[model samples]
Target: MDMNAYLSMFIDESNDHLQSLNENLLRLESEPEELSIVQTIFRSAHTLKGMSATMGYEDLAALTHEMENVLDLVRNSKLKMDSFIFDTLFKGLDALETMVQDIVGGGTGKADVTAIVTSLQLILKSDYSAGKAAQPPLEAAVTTVDGSTSASGGMLLDEFQSSILLQSIEAGLHVYHVHVTIRNNCLLKAVRAYMVFEVLERNGEVIKSVPSVQDIEQEKFDFTFSVFTISGLTQEELQGQLLNISEIEAIVVTALDSETLAVLSNAPAAAAAEAVEATVESSAVKPKAEIAREAAPRKGQAAPAPANVSRTIRVDIERLDMLMNLFSELLIDRVRLEQLSSEIKRSDLTETVEHMTRVSSDLQSIVLKLRMVPVDSVFNRFPRMIRDLAKSLDKKIELVITGADTELDRTVIDEIGDPLVHLLRNSVDHGIETVEERIAAGKPETGTIYLRAYHSGNHVFIEVEEDGRGIHHERVLKTAIKNGVVTEEQAKQLSPDEINMLIFAAGFSTADKISDISGRGVGLDVVKSKITSLGGNVTIDSAFGRGTKFSVQLPLTLSIISAMLIKLGSEKYAIPLSSIVETGILRKEQIINVHGNRMIEFRNGIIPLISLSKVLDSPDFNENDEDETEIVVVRKGEKWAAVMVDEFIGQSEIVLKSLGKYLTNIETISGATILGDGYVALIVDPNSLIK
Candidate 1:
């Protein structure tokens, strides 16, 4: 099979399965008695393992197989799940995700999973039910072993080995029977056993094996295989050396003598049968579809009929982008047809144009919706992240998410993840207080971080709020002054909100020390810049002892937007309607001068008035010299400003076209759009104007 043809599909399905595993595992931790959750997680892991094997990612398949084993034991009531098991499984999931990401980035999905595999194996071998100690390191004893006993207590020996052991015992040397147990799911059993033999040979001379060393070397044995050796080292010394190797589960080094070997060599048949039975039990791995099916109903209850599965088809993003572009061109032509129909005034042309307009409007809605992805796609990964961060930071946190079904443009969704990550980390590390502090403040020990997303009008709003120690205004001002971001005098004049906003200053951090999660002086500023570059705005609201909330407002789609077109003398400009609060006519006398800056009183508050004609250096228009001016009140986040323009050209849908590379750095102009008259009009970014 040509795996390359299915590579894209494999990556997508792998990510979905991994996400399912993460979510269900987190659920299982909270509800450990829920076997159904375990079944779901087991199914996801099983499917992922099968897919990885088919794709030739053996390391991925191997790690998932080990994880599946532990899950199997838990699901089948053979073993109980605990914190250690959950953490081990989560780590395996993390490693699987990392390897899949490596494959996504055009690399072979291989990783060193020896440590994880060994941990999982140890979980299986541990005894949690009786509260007894789990399996210990290598040991030696005179008693016969439970599973198998060959010669000299437990090491199967032949005539040559018995002679060697007897001579060594007579010569006052140490002849020991060593039984090594390998992990059940070890991928390279023969190699690990070989390494054990090499260690034994370096320390001593090997005498014999139960399965005829050839079978062991060829990987023919199950979990346990016995060996007899003569070494001068003590049992402790030899046991310690073998324990250093990776996958061996247990080791028993029984000191041998002439009497013990003679008595043990006589009864090999019964012991060999026992060893064979034990091997069969340990090495058996069966398909776990039964678990998934079994969880469908209680033991005595009837099974319910299956529900209908939602139908969906995976479409490549590039194909969607192409479809959107073609629709955008069609939209431009539609607007041209409407304009020409209005000008020519033919009855048939007018009727046909109106009909085309209605049809295209419906098509536009469908196309835009096709690009709207649920925010849950971005929010689903946060719970596991918060869980890990809470563990790492030693603080208890509960993440409350709402409106995950809110949708945004696929382009916006891709860029929004990093900023949200930064904000969430900030809340986890700095915004949330420690357990002791929270207790002293009469708050719950577990801090809460709320992530919410919703749609308002034509914009989507995302908020990251925390119920912990809020922003300290005095401390923030002092740091801002000491860091040269503001003078002491300037800080004293600033409001609490403005002071709170200073945390977004470049290279600004209030941590006393740097740590991996944060406090390196590089988070909020990046958040601000990234959100701003995406044509969005972020605002902060905090009460010193209460909490802090960061609200980000973003346009629904970046490619096409309904903009309020205006004329700046001979040039036409379009302002995004999402940013416009209202439009009205204002007299020149209403403008007030505040410390040599133009300000205006509107909506019971005073805001800055910016003359677009003067700002854009218009050749034939000046709104300032006129007795009355047409002003468009626009908002950044909470800040507001009025933009003076020569004329309002009504609202229309416009396709946003990038300026390529050279003109991308322009401050006020966001992009250019083709008007119905075939003239290019630059889109104004109200965020730049307001600040």
Candidate 2:
């Protein structure tokens, strides 16, 4: 059989399982007594093992199998959890992730995990330490029932699985317990089982399976198996789907009530392990569809089925990008149509154009949402990273994350990982003090680092702050002066924030010497450059001996957005509505000069005034000497700017188009947009213009 067809799916699922293991293992480390956590880790590993084996990655499968054995022992109370065992399992997980990554990079998922395998073996063989012999206090009863687990392949649901079923029931979904028996003399039992799964999977998500998926694939079961599934299909419909897969078998589907599910969920370990054995007496055969109707509710009535199985599916990001591009072209034409309709003042044309505008607005929202993903996907990896780094540095630090559920563009999420990693590693290496130093400083033994993300208007802000030995101002200034990043006179004139930002300059380092981790004058500069290239800005704030914060302001890029189109001395430009506070007329006399910079006062705050024409070097800017100048007030975080323009063109939806590589590095202009008259207008990046 061809395995190539399944390779991509295998890789995606393997990565998912690996991430699950990492997350659950970290939880287990914190709560070793929580066997429930161990159960989750075990199930993820078990699933990965089956997938890897099916993909012919014996090394990955074998490693997972051994790790599963250890987890089984720990979860069952036959062995105890310890730092040693946790470290070994972590090693196994690391190896598994590496192998999966290799597969993603177009290599066989093979690795020399012999050392990991040996460590797992040793852990399994070693006797439980005397002090750690007993199971967790709450799990004592569960551990006692472990040895009496039934051999019959039964659908045993844990708390996690039970909650899913209960939630499905609440949502008006059907939870079915299906018992399927194969023929006594049936050949290729595995293939038949696969067919049955394919049917059920098409109808619903199988929450739990008897004989375990791996055992069924290995044909370790006698004949019959059971499954617990959640679906929007009625018993008749679901049974029909399953019965289409041919095999000599008897099947029964029981719709479970919440009461019965609760009883089974709280059942003792023994009853929960109830099994289904394959045996043949004698019975007349019937049509598959007939057997299906027999699965109808015994109560003579049924609740409504769910709408359908989930309407969601994984879509490649490239597909979304293509969709956005196509929508951009459609949007341009839509604007053109609206403009023509307005010109002609015809009812039919205007009405049709109005309808198109409404429909396209809804479509535009959906297309933009498709590219937004939760930052949690990126934040989830940091705990494990911090654990390893803290252990290596022999320091005690805790990572506190907030607003992880905040969403950002997938493009930003993909590129932001490495820069965040650099910032985090720097915090651990340079920002946080040693244990002894922390103790002597009248602070807790462990330091705290806050990694947070939040949305404000059109931008998402990410702040990495550490409460430890802050950036040394005198030292950084000396380093900046020595490195030629700033003159000695320039250093004297810099503000505290400006001096803090000096760390992001190319080839600037304050470290007395180079270290393996950070302080090589490399990471921060790269971070600044990468973020800037993404139409974002990074700023640092610090105080002596207190803490430091690096705040990154990022854009929410999409094809279509509402903008205030303006004329810049005969040339048109666009300003995103999200960034604009208000537009008004500012007389030339209202502007003030402060240190050779034009400034204006609005809402009791003084902010800089920037001339759009002067910034863009427009030839027509100086030709007119109007007494009053039109200005748009825009803000980036707390900093505000009044951008001068020639005229306001009112608000309209514009399609954002990127400036290709040849026009890259045009700092003030972030992107281009198409106007109703079919002319291209540069979108001014107000965040870049301010300071």
Candidate 3:
């Protein structure tokens, strides 16, 4: 089999199963007695086991199998639930996840899990023995029924024994009679006997049956039944087939009743039942015989066969990307056509353009939606992570998530996981406090962390809020000063927000001790850079001793953006609409020089200005000939910077094309886009340009 083709599917399904297990385990910890939750966890483990086994990953299979066994013990009421048990099971689950990860990372999924496996096995064994001892009567009842024999002056035959007898007869071998008994708790004994008869008929023709047909039908038989059949089948095959039926007492096939068969050479099929009944009535049979029977049919039958479910075929992500690329090309053509139709001003051509516009717009929406996925797919794994972290740190913390169903472009989704993980680790390690500390501070023992997401006006906002000790502006400022990130004078003049922003400064840490959870002084800086690189912004809001919240705002998509096109000297530029505050034409007299730097006064504030041609090293044009320059006021965080351009062009949606890896060290230009005239305009990275 070409397993390589299924690799992506395997990764996706394995991830889904792991997420399910994690979420269910978190729920089980709170509602340990919830059998449904335990069952769900078991199902996930079972599925992962089957998948891994099929993939030839034995270590993953073995670990998941052990997890399933432990879950089974819990599910069946054999093992009592406790914190210790939960912890051990969670640890086992963690090991299984690690094995799966190893497989994902191109390894053989082999990990030394001998200790955990041994612990789970021992627990299972102990629980099984205890359960067996608790129901002694049940065991003895089964044993006695298994040992009883029929009284035809010959041994009675259990269903299993009868099956063997029939098989031997069919195989041209001598048939035998065996003793049989049924458990006292068995119900519907007559129905069970009938079912057994039906099975026996498959191998041979029944010659002599016991208990008189009327008495057997009226439930007058003891725990055992006898049958004589002639056929040519193997005893082993017959015994195996009968045992497969759910509840059977025992089977013993021996040489009894070997000589009791009267030749029915002239007898028809109708006489077989009567002959068996006569033999039983003539012999002295045991008065106390029990028969096990099936339970009554329930009200609701088994879920209507699962609604004849069908699955969707998964398409390759690469194919989707290619489709999106082709769509982008078509979009460019649409724009060109619209521009041409307007220039010509032909009524019929304009009408056709309008129709094409509607169709193309609809197509664009459908294509964009194809890349949309719910954020919950990523949020689902964190509950379990937070639970485990809280237990390890011996802290009481609550994780509250909202807007989990908010959707984002799949391209953005793929890169957001690591950044979110970093933020969450920071929350648990530094944002929340221990129970003792929280109580001493006159606050509730349990701290709350809120992770929220929502969409607004073509953008998405994700916020992480914690209600523990908030970020200390003084500490942040001091750290910045100590690390030489800012001068002492700069730190002194910083506002509270500016001081809080120092946390994202490189090499900044406020933790008293370095630990695996956080405080490595390498997290938030990377987080900030990552978000910024994705055309997003990260900001902090904090009140000392209250809590802190980090908000990240991102555009809806990255492939194409609505931008304001402008000309600087002879070159054109594209500024993302998401970052544009406002644009206006400014007379040359409105610009002033401050501290040897160009400045512009905008709405009562003197914002620093940079000429686009000067910053981008484009060919300098004669400012003497131009009457006025265009000013674009852009905001990075709290500060605004004005950009000078030669002329103002109208806004249009443009597809962003990356300048491949060959064009390294291009500082301020984020990407390039094609205009309707086939000219390439550079897209500006506002943050980099301003800094």
Task: Score every model by TM-score.
Answer: 0.64, 0.77, 0.62
- Over 1-691, each residue of candidate 2 has an lDDT whose tens digit, in order, gives 6899888778877888888999999999889999779867876887777667667788888899999888877765667898889889988888988988898888988899888899998876666533343434443222111122233323256766888789989888899877777777888777677667656655666777765666787787777777888776887677666675677366667788888788768765445643221111122334455675675566868845643456767788999989998998998999999999999999999999999999999999899988999999999999999998888889999999999999999999999999999999989888988899999988788989999998754678899999888888899899888888999999999998888888888878877776888882558999998997887888888776777888998887767888899887789998889889889998878989999988999999888988888889988775139899888999876778888888888888898788887787787887898787878899888777866
Compared with the true structure, model 3 gives a TM-score of 0.62
In candidate 3, what are the lDDT values of residues 26-86, reduced to their tens digit? 8888898887687567667766776676567778877888778777667655666777667
Residue 338 local lDDT, model 3: 81
Clashing pairs in 1: 150-156, 151-155
Over 4 Å off, model 1:
129-315, 563-651, 658-672, 679-691
lDDT of 2: 0.80
lDDT of 3 at 382: 85
lDDT of model 1 at position 219: 60
- Candidate 3 segments exceeding 4 Å error: 1-8, 127-311, 561-653, 657-691
Error of 1 at 68 (Å): 1.3
lDDT of 1 by residue, 628-691 (tens): 9788998865789999998999999898898766785677777899999999999887876765
